[model samples]
Target: MKIARIEVDGARRVGVVDGDRVQPLAAHVTVEEVLAATPAERTALVDRAADGAPRPLSDMRLLAPVAPPTLRDHITFEEHLEGSLKLLGRTAPPPEWYEQPVFYFSNTNAVIGPDEPVAVPPGCERLDFELELAAVIGRPGRDLTPEQAGDHIAGYTLFNDWSARDLMAPVIPVGLGPVKGKDFANTLGPWIVTADELAPFRRDDRLALEMHAEVNGVPLPGGGDTSASMAWSFEEIVAYASRGAELRTGDVLASGTCGTGCLLEYWAQAGDAAPPPLRPGDVVTLVVEGIGSVSNRVVAGAEPVPVPKARVGHARRPRPWTST
Candidate 1:
């Protein structure tokens, strides 16, 4: 089943998406609440559809599926690893990366939904987009097994980890972040397709879905379906993420970038001339099969706060983003 949060006349309500119409819930339940519900409870929601008639899907604005309690993204694809390393001028991926799945926490407050505008920060000349798949946790669990992990997911949505590549270039070598580079905005949802809805597309381990990325309607560099790609399984990512802590309801975990899902990888593929940095008015879209797509329009906001240039002098390296 597909669920979404739509705003009609400035009032946001959760609903069930059936065909081209959205059956509004008698009581507005946030997507988070839906994720927290039991299968029986979720079924009850579908049953309640008869309580109110669905409105045309075209009549309302779609928002992020959930007001995420927390957001974490895992770097799981080898192609992305190799390409991103080169983008940062590294010869190879770090040894630790091959040993385990790595992820970073992102700014949940900076999220944008479908068709929303992303604000470009000042001083940032290079804005990029990361096409990814995000999994929304359905239940709370700790130290789960990979086998058990699959059951914990509620649904999937398209995720674009909007980035400031120019700002990230300098900080990556220090062995610490993708932070400010990733802090600006995270685009999620056109709608959330329940995990069961995608069960039909599952191949051995990865879903047999075609993933794609586009900028202003022009297809970007490398993007292929998931079956042949996605090195680490979503189960493994979730299991590792839940280790030593609880995976709470509504927490979002993302499959970093699929093969060449971001500009960093594309840069490694096509070099500096592949695609120009994102500018104001540029639109970026991320698409995943069975699931849906989320597109964000770039808009200029306040000049991004300036960062002091790093100058090396007298055998000491000074960092602009952090002092180490």
Candidate 2:
């Protein structure tokens, strides 16, 4: 089932998408609430909601499919890796970058739903968009084997890891994870599709699905093609991340930038010449097959006005600097 959280008449409710229409589930039984419930209870809840009177989808606004996620891991794919590396003047990731799955945590509070406006931060001259597939965790486990990892997946959704490339470049040289550059905004939704629905699309090299992104009405570079270009699998990423650590329900694992997933694929080296950064009134739409498209508008943050300094008389400027 494709599940979603929707706001209707100022109240939030859970629902399932049936074709273009949505059938409200329960006002209180959220996706997180269902995942935390026992299997029997979950099934019963689903049945009860199906039989109960439901509200029409057209009357509501779709919120993020899942409640706030506990944690998020950005998984790297080869096409994205190769494309980014070549742009940086390297042929491929260093031996260690690919020896095992690598990931980075995204800010939980920064997540927003489809159609929400993203605030472009101050000093960010180059903002880019990344189209990706996100995996949601259903069961909790630690040190899981690859086979065991597959069982823990609950669903999938479309994600857009909005980026400020200018702010990102300075911190990457220190080998630390992306901090302020990535914490600004991360977008997901349309809905969360159950694992059973998308299982056939997950494959060894990469899941075969068409993914694309558009800025306003025009398509961006690398905006067309199938997700089959990935060199790694989501299962491998889950297993690797769980090795010696715990994977819990409600955790989100993102398939990092897909090849041609962002403007970085073509303009990373152009430095100051990157396409005009996302600005107010720009609409970004990302579409992933099976799952639906997530569209958001970019709004300029309020510009801070400069305050003028007052001039002081010349008689009081003799303070000396002391070393600590």
Candidate 3:
């Protein structure tokens, strides 16, 4: 069953998407609430929700399929990694790069759903977008074997990890990791397609899927086959991630950017061209097969204002740093 969050009449509620209409779930359950429900109970609740008065999908705002997630783990796709390495002047990833999966923690608070507006931060002159597939963890498990990992997934959704290249450049030199460059904003969903529905799509080496992104109305990137490019399987990633840590419900694991998934691969070359990043009034739309599309608008940053100087009588002295 496809699940989504919708806002109708100014109130947010969970719902199941059917055709162009939505069937509201029993009240607006929090992410934790839905995760806590048993699979059988969850299925029954969705069925009952669908029995209610239906609303046109176009009339309501589609929020992220999953509620506020606890964490988002980004897994590297071979195509993206190879392309990125070449862009950085490396011949290929060091042998050890593929020995195990690598990931980074992204801010769950930065997530927004379909058709939402994302703020283009100041000083970030090179904004980019990545088209990816994200897996939602269903059952809780840690140190799970690869054979057991498949049962832990609940569903899948399309993810767009908006990036700021300019902000990322500085941090790379410090070796601190992708902190500021990545945390800006991440987009997910049109719906969370349950694993059972997507079972046929998942494969050992690659998921046979097509992905594409458009800037405004023009197609920017994507036309390649995902099945031919992926380096690892979702099961491997889940198993690796849960080695010692517990994998809980509502945790999102993302397939890192796809090859030619963003302009960073097609338009710009390292140290040569840094095109003007996404600005206010621009829209980015990402489409993945099976899963629906997610579109977001880009808005300008609010101008910074200056603060007035403190009054003379209220001025404070600086504290001494040296210990006597």
Candidate 4:
């Protein structure tokens, strides 16, 4: 079943997509609640909702399937990593990257839904979009094995990790994760396709779904990548993420950019022939087979607030309780 959240007036409603129509659930029913329901309970809810008159999907405004409580993104595509490393003049990923899947937390407050506007941050000229797939956790689990973790996933959705490459360039040397470069806008929508709905697309553990991206009706670089190229499977990523923390319902775990999914990789690979950075009014769309697409328009951002520059402070003398 393809589940979606739609905007009714100013309120949000959850529904199941049936072809061109939507089977609306109760007003109080939320995507999170549906995800947490048992298989039997979910079937019953859908059955009950189907009894009501359905609405045309094109007539309703779609929202992000869920407002995630926690958002984590993992770099699992070997080709993406290798291509990205070329920007730093490296031809290969770090040795540790091969040992385990690496991920970083993103700001949940920055999340947005389909057809929303994404602003280019102040002073940013290199705005880019990452094509990715995210899994929503349905059941809570801690220290789960790969086999157990597979049961925790409710479904998958298309994810766009919007980036400000110019703002990111300086932060990389600081040894910290992305700050203003990211956390500005992240997109997860059109809708969520239940895990069972995508069963035919699964090859072993990795999905064989074709992923593609376009900018302003023009196809972008890295258009032929597939989820099957991921070196670390979602099962492994979920298990590793649950090592010391709980995976809660509505929590999102995103597969990092597919190989050549972003303009950064295109720029790194095509020095002179690369396209210019995104500007106001440009539209970016990411599509994943079996899942739907999430598209956004770029708009001008508000002026930034100024702050004083950092300065050196006096060092404090060391305190010693015992000296040898």
Judged by TM-score, which candidate is best? Answer: 4
What would the per-residue lDDT of candidate 4 be over residues 146-230, giving only the tens digit for each residue?
9988789889999999999888889888878888999799999999888888999999877789999999978785465999998
Candidate 1: residue pairs that collide: 121-304, 122-303, 122-304
Residues 173-245, candidate 1: write the lDDT tens digits. 7867865787889988988888888999888876667888888988775445473477778888899999998
Report the error of model 3 at residue 248, Å.
1.4
Q: Give the range of the ten consecutive residues with the poorest summed lDDT in model 4.
A: 315-324
**Candidate 2: stretches off by over 4 Å:** 36-43, 50-52, 204-206, 221-223, 269-274, 303-324
Residue-wise lDDT of candidate 2 within 1-324, one digit each (tens)? 777888866877777787767777756677876655555666677888763556666677998887555556565777777767775679877888767777888888888898999988667777788888888888887888878777787778888899987878877887886666788888889888877777688666446888888888677664576767655577777888788888787788887887767887767546444566677788999988888788999888755356586677767545567334
lDDT of each structure? Answer: 0.82, 0.76, 0.75, 0.87
Runs of candidate 3 exceeding 4 Å displacement: 28-41, 49-51, 204-206, 268-276, 303-324
Clash pairs, candidate 3, are none
* lDDT leader: 4
Over 189-237, each residue of candidate 3 has an lDDT whose tens digit, in order, gives 8988877777677665446677778788777634644733667677778
Give TM-scores for every candidate, taking all chains together and pairing residue i with residue i: 0.90, 0.86, 0.86, 0.95
Better of 2 and 4 by TM-score: 4
lDDT of 4 at 39: 66
Q: Which stretches of candidate 4 lie over 4 Å from their true place?
A: 49-51, 315-318, 321-324
Write the candidate numbers in order of decreasing TM-score.
4, 1, 3, 2
